[model samples]
Target: MNSDTPQLKSFRSFEARQDGDRQTSRSESYLRTGRESSVISATIQADSTGRDMSIDLDVSADATHLKRFVVSVDFGTTFSSISFLILPRNTPPDSLDPHILYHHIQTIDHFPEEPCLGLAESRKEVPTEIWYPKEEYLEDSIMGDGTGSDDSPEGDMPFHLQNEDEENTYWGYEVYSCQRIDTDPNQNRRMGGFKLLFDESELTAQIRLDLEPTLDMMKKKKIIKDREDVISHYLKHLFSHAKEELSEKHEYTNDCPLGFVLCVPPIWTPKACRIMQTNMVRAIQESGYGSFGNCIDNLFIVSEPEAAAAYVIESTTTVLPKEAFMLLDAGGGTVDAITYTVNQTCPLRLEAEGVEAGGALCGSSYLNKAFQEHLSARLKDEDYLERNGISIRSIVDTEVVKFENNIKRKIDIIRPTSVFEFVEIQDLRADPRKNFGRNRLRLTHNDLRGIFLPVLEKVSGLMERQLELAKMRRINVTKVILIGGFANSPSLRSFLKRKLASIKSYQDEDIPLWARRRFLVPSSEPSTRETGRDASAVQVMDFDVMNRSILMTSLLTGESFPIASLWMAGST
Candidate 1:
C-alpha cells in the first residue's frame, strides 16, 4: 500500500518527496525515492537508426481514461487468469453498437472458454492458497510431539514432541501434513507464511510477473486457519499487482466493466462452494479492485468438467442434434462424469456424478503407501539397520521427497543407470560412512516403479467403475476427458490407456488418438470411429468440456419453457 515497497522504490521515479503527498501523486514519490533521481521522466524508445532515444520530463501527472472499462479475473487454487473489457471508443452508451463491441472483444485463440493445457498435459488453473498456524496453538502442537527446540537459527522452527524422536523432524507444508518436521522449525521455514511475502512495496512488480504455482506453505491440517481469510489476503495482493501491471501497460482512469468465470470441480459440496465464493468475493474487495464501489459483474461459476467441455465444443465445427453423451473428467482432485443431451429444440439437459478420489490426494497417497510397504518388506531388524546411521526408514523418507519433488527426473535417471527397478529413502541425517550402501540403494530403482505402478492401477479402476455406471444408464459415453493437474503425468495416462485396452472389445488402435497423445483433445477431433468396448473404459481428455457445459447451463438453467407458437407452413 506504500511506495516504500522495494520494487517500487527501486525505480528512480519513486523517490520520497519533501512536500510529499503519498495518495495524490505516486509519480512524485517514485522520482524522489530509493534510487538516484537523475533519470526521472526518461522515456526509452527505439528509432529507425536502431538507437535508443530518451525524453526527459520535469513533472509527471496521473493518467486519465476516456471510455468504459472492465476486467475479469479467474482465481484458481493453483493458478489464475485475467481479462479486460473495453467500451466502444467514441459511441455513447445508448448508441453503442453491439456487433462492434463483440468484434473488439478478444476471444482466447485456443480453447476460448478454458485456459490452455500444456502440450500432452491436462489440468487448468493455478493455486494461490497459503497455510499457517496460530501462534497460540503452535506450542501445544509442537510439545505433544517430543524433543524440545534449541534456540539455534537452524532449529528456530524446530519441533519438540513428547513421543516422537528428537531427530525425526520435518518442515514446510509436508511437516504439518505428514507430522515429520519439528513444529517450530517447520513453521519458520514454511514458504507461505512470513517468508511468502515480498515487501508490500515490491509486490507491485512481482505480481506483474507470472509466478510458478505451488502450495509452498500449505499445511496438511484439516483447519490450520480460516481458508477464506488466507485466500482473501492472497487475492488482494494479486489484484493490486495486476492493477499496477495494467497501469504500466495502458492509460485508464474510469472503472472497467469486468466479467469473471470461476471453475470448480463438479464434486464441490455446498459448504465448499459457499466458502470458495465468499472467499473470492472478499479477496476481490481486499485486493482494492472493489474499493471504488465498482465490482466484477457477470460473475459465473462453472464445473471443472463442464469448463473442459466448453473448450472441446468451442474448438469444433460440428454441431450436435440433441443427443446425450457422457463426460468423464479425471483430474488431480477427483473423477467426475456427466451426461449432457445436446438438442436443437431446447437447451442441453445435464446430470452428473463424482467421487472423492482425485489424482492429487488419492494417487499421491497411494504412491506413498506403496513406497512405505516396499521399504518395510525389504528391510528387517538388525540387518545393517542400526549401524552407520543407515536404516530402511530413512531411505523411505528420502525417496518420498524425491518422489514428490522430481519423481519423473529420478525415473529418467534410474531408467538409464540401473536395471528397471525403483528406489526410495528418506535420510535427512544420512551418514557419510554409508556411501557404499547408498550406492547399493541407488540400484533399487525398481522399488520406485513398483510403488507408483499400483497407485496408477487404482486410478484406472476408478475410471473403469465410472464408465460402468454410465453404461448401465444406457448413456452414450462419448469422449472420456482427462483433466486437472494429475492428468499431466505420463504414468497415469499410460495406466489409464491400459485399462481401456483391457475392457472387452477395445482395440488399441481404436482408442482416440487424442487420448493416446494424452492431451485434452480439442473439440475438433473427429468422432468418426466409435469404440465397441464395454462402453465404460473409453474416456476423452479435453480442456473445454467443463466450461462449455457451464455456458450452456447459464444460458438454459432458468429460462421459461419455449412456447411452440401457432404456425402454418404456408402462412405467408
Candidate 2:
C-alpha cells in the first residue's frame, strides 16, 4: 500500500450545498473503537425565507488524527460507475468541499473482467448486467440462438450442472462477453433491471409490461427469490470490486471510516429506498467492508437529481443565481426530465419547479427495440435464417458495439446521405430494396431516423412539457443540461434542438421577442430574430464529463436501467 493514491488532476477550489429551512441534524454515531471520534462543527446560515440554505462543510483537519473515506456508487440500468474520496479524520463532522473532494476523487476505470470488444471508445462505466452460470461459462459458447441460451438441451440446464468445477457469477463487461458466446437462460441465471422493481407501486403500466416477461423468466428459472435477493447478489459484485480497487490503489484496509453516498431515482418512494438499503446493507456485510464495526451506519442516500446537481456544481465555473435549467437524464431504460431553479451561485442551491418530474420508459433501449423490430421484419426467410444460423436478436446483441458507434450515437436528421452498415453475412443474399445489400443490413439516414425519432419524440415531449410548465410559472429556463448514456446520442440532441425551433411563439409575435423569449430556437434559419443565439439552449455533455460523473444514482433492471445513466440506477 503506497502512502499516496490517485490525486485529482483536474479542478481547484470546492463548493457544496446544504439547503433546508433551518435544520441541524447530526450524523449517526461516528465513534470507532480505539480511535478518535469525529466531531463535525458546522456554520449554518439562513435565507430570506428564514430557511437555512447556507452550510459550509469543508473544514480542514490535522493530518495525524485519522483518515475518512467517501465512496459514491451509480448502480444503473445499462452501465454503472464508482468514485471514492479520502480525507483526514481531524475535521470530524465538517463537510468535504466537493471541488476539492472531486480533485482527489477517482472513478473506477477498470473492472473485474473487461473484455476486448470492438467498442468505439473506453468509458468509465461498466455494464450493469450480471450472470450466475448454470453449466458454468466455458470459453467457447459465443454463437447461439440469440435467446440467451447456453447451447444446451433442456435436460442439461438443471441447477445441479452449475458447478462441475465452478459456477462463477460474472458482472459488467464479463456478462456481455460471456452472454454473447455462451449463456443458458434455462439453466444459468442471468439478472438485470431488478433495481426498477424496488417499489411495485412505482412501476408504470408500460414498465410492468416490459418487465413482466423477464420477471416471469426469472421465476421460471428460479433466478431470484425476491427483490432483495437480486439486489443483494448484484451489490455483492459491486462492493467486492470497489473494496478491491481501493485496496490495490491505497492499500485500502477496512480500518478507516467508510461511508457510501448512494444515488436513487426521484420517482422512488421512501419504501423503495428502504427496500434497497436493506439489501445493500446485507451486501456490505457479505462483502469485506463489514469486517469492522458499523460500516453501514453512515450510508447517505441522495436523489439522482441532487447527485446530478453535485456533478454540475463540480464542473461549471460560473452559475447565474436564479438561473433555471432542465436536466434531462436519458439512459438505457428511463428518461427523467426535471427543472431546477438555482438559488445561489457558489454553494449552489436548487429548487424543483412546479412542472413535476416527467419520467418515461423512452430511453436508448427503445432505439434498440426499434432496431430489433426492423430486423424481425427484414430477416424472416427461414432458409436465409437457417443459412445464417443466427437470430435477429443475436446479431443486434453481438453488433451492439457497432450500433453504439454508428446508429446509436451518430444517427441524425441532417445526414440524409449517411448510411449505417451492421454485421455482414456472406451467405445470405443481399436485397437492396429491403435495405440489405453488399452482405450487410445497410440503414440509410431515413432508416436510422425512423429508429431514433419515436424515442426522441417522447424525450422531446417530456422536455417541452416542462418548458411549457416553466413558462406558465414565469420561470425562465436557460440551459437544458443533458446527461446519461442515452444522452450520448448526437441525434437526440439534434432532434431536441429541432423541436425547440418548431415551438410557436409563446405570445403573438409583436416583432418576435428575440432576446426575451424563454425557450431557445434550435436552428438559425427559422428564428424570426438573429441567428447568433440560435441552438443556444441545448447542452449535450461530452463523454469525458459523462464518464467523470457526479450526482449519480443506481437502480435495478429497468425500461433499459438508468437513472446514473443509477441506471435502473439499479442500486440507488
lDDT of each: 0.34, 0.50
Q: How far is candidate 2 from the true structure (C-alpha RMSD, Å)?
A: 14.7
Candidate 2 lDDT score at position 321:
68
lDDT of 2 by residue, 444-511 (tens): 66777777788889988888887787778776776677666675566776777666665532342111
Q: What is the TM-score of each candidate against the true structure?
A: 0.48, 0.69
Q: 1-572 in candidate 1: lDDT tens per residue?
A: 12222222222232222113233433432232221122222111101112211222112442132233334344433234343433322222222211112212211111112222334322222233333342322243432111111111112122221223212322222232432332222332232322112212232234323221223222333222332334444554455555664454333433543333344444444334444444455545544443433221233333455444443333232325444444444432233445544443112223333322222223333454566676556554325554454455554555554454445313432132455443433332333442224433342455556666666666666666655655565545444555434555566666666566655312112222123111121111111121222111111212222221111111010001000000011111
Which ten contiguous residues of candidate 2 have the minimum total lDDT?
516-525
Model 2 misplacement above 4 A: 1-67, 93-95, 112-121, 135-166, 183-188, 199-203, 209-223, 290-292, 387-392, 502-572
Q: Could you give me the TM-score of model 1 versus the true structure?
A: 0.48
Candidate 1 at 529: error in angstroms?
Answer: 37
TM-score between model 2 and native: 0.69
For candidate 1, the per-residue lDDT at 277 reads 43
Worst 10 residues of 1 by lDDT: 558-567
